[model samples]
Target: MRTAVGIDLGGTELRAALVAEDGRLLARRSTRTDAAGGPEAVLAQMTGLVADLDLAGARPVAVGVGAPGPLDAEAGVVTGPPTLAGWHGFPLRERLAAALGLSVAIDNDGHAAALGEWRFGAAIGRRHFVYVTVSTGIGGGVVCDGRLLRGRGGLAGHVGHMIVTDDDVVCSCGNRGCWEAVASGTAFGRQARRAAAADPAGRIAALAGTAPADARHVGTAAREGDPAALALVAEEARRLGAGIVGLIHLYSPEVVVIGGGLSALFDLFAPVIADAVATRAMPAFRDVAVVPAALGPDAGLVGAAALVLAPN
Candidate 1:
């Protein structure tokens, strides 16, 4: 079977994989992004990762990358994504093409993940849906009428930056009241840490066990029925659901697939998120399926490959 090279470049790690068209991961390699080293350093590391993957004698036809955005997908340029500092105006697609001697494609990581789920995971066969990744930051992609919505600048899927509240929380994107500033894993961890500080004897602190509290600890404590953690989770779900409600109003999607780090605990959050949607969404949109993303952590990688395998 023919294969493609997919790279998932994040603020913390750079991962590349050899993947079959059928969504099978043939081989993979990864390393820390060391983002502070600048674009050239990270580019070299990404190239090395692809070279390290076991290709099994099958030459990849193309390379696709899912990177943090504020990018120009059509132009294949990285245009000052908040997470990838120093990558402003970098011609990522052009550079990768030169480095790999293959055609290159690139898109926002969120958009890539949505494409992955659409083709091979949860949203398969669905013509309309939204995919949200609630990780260190919130990011999303919208599939409308069988097409991923890539606006003029390929910036249509930036649901995270949607201003969902009037609070003073400043997002990494330099905006106030962004959904990401309040509902992302980073927000959850910050809330957990604050709760832990106030109540050093609380379940969240205990779960942290001398380490810093994060979203995982909150999930664990909530699962254990700790009141503070439970409250935190409830607030998180409500804020997340509010964002989804906005999406429903805008897209009226058939489903909303939740993914990313916090999604590991979707079993616990789904119910609350669904309830929030049920109460807040219009009656016409209440029946939309709110489900966990099936692709897990590989969604972005597979979606990146899908960009090469299936352009749309």
Candidate 2:
């Protein structure tokens, strides 16, 4: 079976894996992204990682990278993604290709995750689906007619920036009322902290532990039956659901897969999300299944592999 090298580059860490054509991970390695050192340092770390992924005798056909975007995928350049400072216009694909002596393909992490699910996880055999990751921020990827829907500039599927409210919260993209600004993990964290500060005697504050309050603390408090935390989580779910409803109205996908760090709390929020979609989506779109991603944390890595093994 043919194999390929898959690299998932995030704001804080980088993961590389050798994956077979059938989607099995063969070997893997990970390291912190030296993002503070700038793009050159990050590139060096990526190259070194690829060199270290003992592929044995199975030579990789190509390298596939799933990186945070606002990138020019066609040109293989990073275009000022807020997560990666000093990466504006950096020729990541060309640099990786030169260092690894292999052709490289790159796309936004959200697209890669969607592709990965389409190829080997929840959306398999489905011709139309959407994948949304809600973490520090929200991002999305869409597959229609069995093909990834990268727009003319490979900038499609950025569902996070879609306006969902008239609130004053500003997004990292500098937009107010973006879906991400109101519904992402960052938003949850901010809200949780505010709630904690407002009610110093509440369980929400104690649930936060020594760390700053975040979505996870909200989940913990909710799980422990804190009504205030439950209400906050419910609100987050509703906001997220509103975005998914918009996506459903636009794409009419067969399935919507949710992933990312915040998805760990899916159980607490899934019902609210499902209810919102069922009640708010158009009749024809109501049947769309909203599901959790099956590949878990490996979705990006596998999706990166799919970029080379099953280019779309």
Candidate 3:
């Protein structure tokens, strides 16, 4: 069976896999990203991980890597990515090809993720949809007419930068009051910490040893009927919904897929987000079905591999 290698490069770690054309995982490997050493080191680490997977006889055709951005997809370079500190203007595709000695493709993580779903996951039958994942940060990919929309310089569905909350939360993009700043995992941790510090009696506050009472912890507490924790989650769900509603109005996707670590509590937040959208979004936009991301962290890996195998 002919195969391809896919790599998902994030700020914290790098993952790669050998995959079948039909979306089966043949092999996989992972390594920590060298963000501290800058882009050169990060790229080198990615190269090493792919090598370790060793797709010897599978007829590896191409490589696809999904990275955090602002990226110049046309140029195969990452431009001033805020999530990856000190790695500015990284020539991703060039570096990987030189190191691995293989033809390579690169894309913003969101765009890569969208492609993964359309090709291998839930969006396979859907022609128009958006895959939005809220992880350490927020990101999304737009698919219209069965093509992933790579808006100028790979910054199209940067809905995380949308200013939904009035709070002055600073975004890595050097902006205040951005949606990511208020609605992502980073935001959840930040808010949970503040709430914990202020309310010593609250579940999040009383629960020591947990890191910053993040979205996960808060969600857990709310599930157990903790009022203070419920409040935190409710606020986050509201902001998340507001941002999503904006995407709905703009893209009119047939479905909106929400993934990422934060999505562990999709059951807790989904209804709240849907309610917010119902009340806030225009009636026409309100019909867009909101759903959980079909692919997990594996979505990026599967998607990246798919890119190499299919190469549109």
Candidate 4:
């Protein structure tokens, strides 16, 4: 029962967990990420967290980190992560290794989550698969041949930045008409708010207690049977399913697991995404089963800790 530490870094806080080789979460905790002080300060706090966990005598092989993307995993450097300001060109893996005196591996957060799910979650017993999480942005990861398929530089799963439609919306990635701009949780929520504002009958307005402005509100309204909210959700499902179609064409996975707060409405969206995939994806790709992520909110930490147990 060896253990390793897995860190999930984000714009607001950093979550670390001690995970056993078999996917049990032995210990888990979190700390706020100070955006003003930048990556160095965050790194310091992260190291302190690992120290607090008392891993000084642990036998885990390595530390696995799930970080915001656009990173240079091989070089251990963060080229530029837009969500976290001043993280440009930061030596993430090297800095953590030096701070913890342990080998460190860094990955795009989505890829890490996908790896986590594959190793120990619903993705178990599956071969080719795709993972999509819609939070601050729509993040994705690919698993092929029972291994994570991060592309060169590990930015391969930047599905949010993919241009699915030629709509006029702009993505944070600075690309016009990117999928994130149109169908991400951010976008889903934004659209719901707009509709609610224009039409007081929209359910998201009441659910948010005042015309909410994030996908969570929309999903809640959809669950409650709001017409406007349901339409928005339908759009989200189609958009998300379209993305799944692309992955199916590329990897031909046995299953597609989707998670994140927004995915709570999987019952409402799965059919739409499934319908879209069937309509658009090739026949061979059509048979893939699309399902909800087995692990809930803590998938990243669970999967990350498992990274330490990977045999060399």
Q: Indicate which candidate wins on lDDT.
A: 1
Q: Which residues of candidate 4, in runs, are more than 4 Å off?
A: 54-58
RMSD of each: 0.9, 1.0, 1.7, 1.9
TM-scores of the models, in the given order? 0.98, 0.98, 0.94, 0.93
Per-residue accuracy of model 3 over 129-231 as CA lDDT, tens digit each: 9888898889888888777888787678887887876777788777999888888888888888888888877787767445556776687788989988888
Candidate 1 per-residue lDDT, tens place, 192-256, comes to 99999999999999989899999889988988899999999888888888999999999989999
Candidate order by decreasing lDDT? 1, 2, 3, 4
Q: Rank the candidates by TM-score, best first.
A: 1, 2, 3, 4
The deviation in Å at residue 228 for candidate 4 is: 1.4
Tens-place lDDT digits, model 2, residues 101-205: 999999999999888888999999998999999999899799998889999778899999999889898999998999999989888889999999998888888
> Which RMSD does model 2 reach against the true structure?
1.0
User: Roughly what TM-score does model 4 have, to 2 decimal places?
Assistant: 0.93
TM-score for candidate 2: 0.98
Q: Candidate 3 vs. truth: CA RMSD?
A: 1.7
Clashing pairs in 4: 128-253, 189-214
Candidate 3's error at 120, in angstroms? Answer: 1.6
Error of 3 at 24 (Å): 1.7
